[model samples]
Target: MKIRFLFILCISVFQFISAQTLSPNAQVSILTIGPGSSLNDAFGHNIFRVKDPLNNIDIAYDYGRFPFNEPGFYLNFARGKLNYSIGKSNYRDVRDFYKWQDRTIKEQILNISAEEKQAIFNYLKNNYKPENREYLYDFFYDNCATKIKDVLESTLKGKIAFHEPVAFEQKSFRTLIQDNLDYNSWGSVGIDIALGSVIDKTATPEEHMFLPEYIHSFFGIATHGHSKKQLIDNENTLYEQQNLKTHNSFLTSPLMVFFLIAIIILFVTYKDYKNQKRSKYLDVILFFVTGMIGVFLLLLWFATDHTATAQNYNLLWAFPLNIVLIWKLKAQKPWVIKYLKFLVIMMCLLIFHWVVGIQMFAYALIPLFVTMIIRYIFLIQYFQRSNSR
Candidate 1:
């Protein structure tokens, strides 16, 4: 009986040993597919195995525009859903932005004028409100960081244990920055919404304040096994060359808040006037026009703040409801109006944003241009004819 048990135990141990453990500095293997000789022969394989950044060759399996620090964990292991980068220039800008941070964000921010430093400190004091910063960071990290870690730990457990601390080195690492509405101190706060901001280590990592710092730190951990501080200072020159500053990116974030309020009033008043007149024809056309505008705002929200971070913009359903109110202008086809309203409600539950950010705002020009062409050709001609007569 003892001999039989020993043989069984040995067999179980052998079975366990056969499962390979990935090395601490091993490449991050991501699967892809290629054309097969026959339809049945097609298969997915680990095609893009990311090289360790610390290696002499320094190969980057670029994650491109996806926001998370750990590409492997964010793109593959977590949910199998992918946020693919569509534009090459767009992807390169984002990549270069982070690479700049990984290279020299530390000393760069330190070189700011005292006025800028004081301004940031003052802004943090007024805005973050102590616990709010950490609370928000933890909130974001809970969704963005912790989930990725769980996937990594869970997927690699028993197969590979993390021997090195899963944190970035603090020495060579610096906070990467970009121009966003919320953190726009670099530009005049009065205008040009996409002004830039970087994390100030002088303060406790605060949401909006500290979050950028952790982003740079986490990105280093994700890309290079080295901690944030461990990255080589010499790499920063390559980073500097990549970031060619041109005309600054702009956004109208402040005006948008006020714009929403004014439009709501305009919509309500117009509907009320039409209700008394029972203008069925005008109401019908207005519904389609307003719905298009609402969808336009949502597209900007998604493009700017990113999908994972777009909870605030999700509440922008008010834009579509304006269409329903246009229908309530007391038309015979109230059913069509009600249907449009319902559709608007459903979309509101769908769109989301991180609340504080910038957008192409110009992306609005797409729908705007289309609608304007129809209006100018018709309305402008009608006005000219009336005046001529």
Candidate 2:
């Protein structure tokens, strides 16, 4: 209890000191952290830092902090209603956290006047209040990085003009996201299955600032209002990431595993075809898996508030009706044959969609798609023979 009391007392003193007026030596900077190995860290992070040695004030503001302990965490995340908050932390603690993760950290000192810096610092302090902290988090429009960009723009109030970075080009949201993900990894596959055609549209140059590295590049070249002066006073790397050897298991790679499954399925399918026999187990499992995936996509589209999931075209291949077809395969109903034909047509449609740049499916799906076509064709022939017999 004494330790807790001392901790609380220290925090109170720190807050009191931080709220004091800033001296001329006070500086506000942006900290950009590079990506890490995990899926969650594929995209980098952006943070606001305020330091005043005169007042012994040094703190970092993080806008990506979410209230995971709040009620309905899972439900709200799925419904796209999760709220993130601006969290204040010790600057050294924040730096150490990223350093421990081996992520490179860079800081950009702003060129604004001390008064402007004070105003920005005060605004951040006010925003960190419990009542004002939480904000609706949007992946494309209002993520952690965008919060920093938007906050600076709003606080500066026409005092800054963000220019397009020389290294930037207009790319689609899906392409930008996929650049940080391996084509055959589970994260890539899951994202491809969840998001829809809306992400395929090309993003504007300004829209690219949603990523942290882009924010760093753009802000470095930004100009002061009505003047050609640069917005950044100085830039320096705070911590450089050290090189580390990485080893990935080849057996677990998506391409290797999926191709093996495809080969086995095709071999069994070919044997069944030559013997004029059907593998009821294989058909049941295929229908069940595809149908379940289709059902999940349907739920994400209609039941959830996820905007990017609304117009998904993966249903063309998953085919939700396969759930019912699982049992219907035994009877070899006439309509079931037509349904298999429709499935084949839908696969063709998926390929057309991919070609036309409507939506980009996972590259690992190639082997699975080939297996699907072969098996569906074999099933059609078997059904036709049974109908004739």
Candidate 3:
């Protein structure tokens, strides 16, 4: 019984195929399944598609040979191949006044034999295997997603569907996907080149760091210092004449702030000591306070100039020092408060550095700001816990 059904189905398909004439010249509109299969009718016009044999995918449909004269077929028909094919097509639909261009098409047709021309037409008409047809769609969707986007646009009218084939074999479908053969490669290449140019033009003074984003957003380089560390040797003769003087000036400017903060902290501790008398020993406070100063010194060193590469890395040593110091001062409370006050002052200076002249600051303030924030959080947590206790 199953065999009988299969035979009937084959017979029915052959009848349908026979009903369809080889007019490759008939009304060029697409019929969903591809140049050959009719899926459904819309707007009383059929949408065409080419089927994928391997993936069960059906690409968008095209109408027909575009009357074989537009820029698309303009070349083949003008070269006489299309004209000859049209003459060969039994479809009575061939227009009487059809013409081809001289430059793109007419000359090429003279070179091919009639037999070869027929073979070409036959291939376009019948022999385009489902696998090869699969390639066209893959070429568009995978490699030329952009072009596929352009052609699938609505403005071309419904007649463009017939240009597609239906049902390609599995191997052909995958082959097209693997091979990227289209306009995207060029587009990406152009973008990369443009980005390289930006990197060349706008590298930072301290970094001279190559950045690709500079191409897309030219101004990004201006505010681009998310984090940066610059290293420049001060061993040169210019160091003694310039950087040495600059370093000395930086060392002194923060002196007033340091003294003022220290005095206020000492006053607070003295008041606490008087309230509790000998019960409030200064050991804990002194230990914690010294740790804060050590941290502040590192920040000061980094903020002195834009080029602080080694200063930043060497600053990492401060961590182990911090762990040891905190353990030693574990019992200190008053000292911790005084140190917290010192950190608050440094935080203010960090912001000022960002605003005054990041370029002159060489943007060293970024890390200083981060360190101050983390330290500030620790101070806040300690105060909150102490107040509750």
Which stretches of candidate 1 lie above 4 Å from their native place?
A: 1-58, 65-80, 83-235, 239-244, 248-321, 331-389
| Alpha carbon lDDT of each predicted model | 0.32, 0.89, 0.29
Candidate 3 residue 296 C-alpha distance from true site, Å: 14
lDDT of 2 by residue, 1-389 (tens): 99999999999998787567898999999999998888878899999999999888899998889877888998999888888889999999999999999999999999988888988898899999989999988888888899988888888886788788776688999999998777778888889989999899999888988888888999999999777799999999999999662535668877788899899889999999889999999999999999999999998899887778878999988989899998788434889888899999999999999999999998888899999999999999898998888
Instruction: Tell me which of candidates 2 and 3 scores higher on TM-score.
Output: 2
Better of 2 and 3 by lDDT: 2
Total clashes for model 3: 28
Ranked by TM-score, the better of candidates 1 and 3 is 1
lDDT of 3 by residue, 242-288 (tens): 11111223333333334444554455545544553221244345435
TM-score of 3: 0.19
lDDT of 1 by residue, 1-389 (tens): 99999999998886554322222343332212221222111111111122223332212221123435655644342332434221122223534544544422221111222332233223323323433222111222232323223323343331222222255233210121222222322222221111111111222322222233343333232321322232212212223323433333334443343345345444544564445323344445555555565654455345443323232232233255556555354334435444545544444333222123221112222232233223223333333443455
- Order of candidate numbers by TM-score, starting with the best: 2, 1, 3
Top-scoring candidate (TM-score): 2
